[model samples]
Target: MSHVHRDRKKLLTRVRRIGGQVAALERALQGEADCSDVLVQIAAAKGAMQALMIEVLKGHLNEHVVAGKTEAVRAREAEAIMQLLGRYAR
Candidate 1:
């Protein structure tokens, strides 16, 4: 629990950074950036988003969902998160 608490901050920070990057990308697009430039920003935003999910999912699995024998609960959480991640991954 203590360990889990510690790592959550980093995960949150990463996600917030990604959110900021997304906002920046939005602003860039609104400013009529070139097509290739917009695409580059979008690809970067997608990568950041993917990284955020990966960090959070791995943390949860390492700390909460996989630390005990709550098979049903872990399964539920894992399935839900993985489903959401699956869409993002594609």
Candidate 2:
């Protein structure tokens, strides 16, 4: 099974927390929160998203790329991950 499937509960929990952060951010905006407070909310939501991405990326690398059965397969997986990272960076 895939790492994501294996860790579905844990990942879902993180996702839920991130969702809460986003909701809070929306509420802050609707309430006309101070600029600094809004900025902090945005930062919190962004950080949560980054953390989730990193966790998934790490799992993919460990399960799909590093543990691949063949060198060619591993190379392909690594290349795909690199491409994904490039797009994510932009």
Candidate 3:
């Protein structure tokens, strides 16, 4: 968990910036900014969100999921990972 603290912080910051980008997108739309510019902002927000998701998934796989020591625990980790993959895939 401590190992991921830095990554978590980075992800949090990314998310916060994405939120700002969303607000900017709204303003751009109302201000009649160029369509391309508004779409670029939207795409940036989506990329930030996807990056955050990847960070979380990597943390899980590298920590709790891989650190499992027992068959049952490993199985549960696999299940958790499967569920996460499903969500992310969609």
The best candidate by lDDT is 2
TM-score of each: 0.70, 0.96, 0.79
Q: Rank the candidates by lDDT, best first.
A: 2, 3, 1
Name the TM-score of candidate 1.
Answer: 0.70
The C-alpha lDDT values of all candidates are 0.78, 0.94, 0.82
The ten-residue window of minimal lDDT in model 2 covers 41-50
TM-score, structure 2 vs. true: 0.96
lDDT of 1 by residue, 1-89 (tens): 54447787887788788888888889888998888888888898888877876776677777666774698888887787778778876
Model 1 worst lDDT window (10 residues)? 1-10
Backbone Cα, N, C clashes tallied per candidate:
0, 0, 0
Q: What is the Å distance of residue 21 in model 3 from its true position?
A: 1.5
Winner of 1 and 2 under lDDT: 2
Off by over 4 Å in 1: 2-4, 70-90
Q: TM-score winner among the candidates?
A: 2
Q: How much RMSD separates candidate 1 from the native structure?
A: 2.8
What is the Å distance of residue 69 in model 3 from its true position?
2.7
Candidate 2: segments with Cα more than 4 A from true spot: none
* Root mean square deviation (Cα) for candidate 3: 2.1
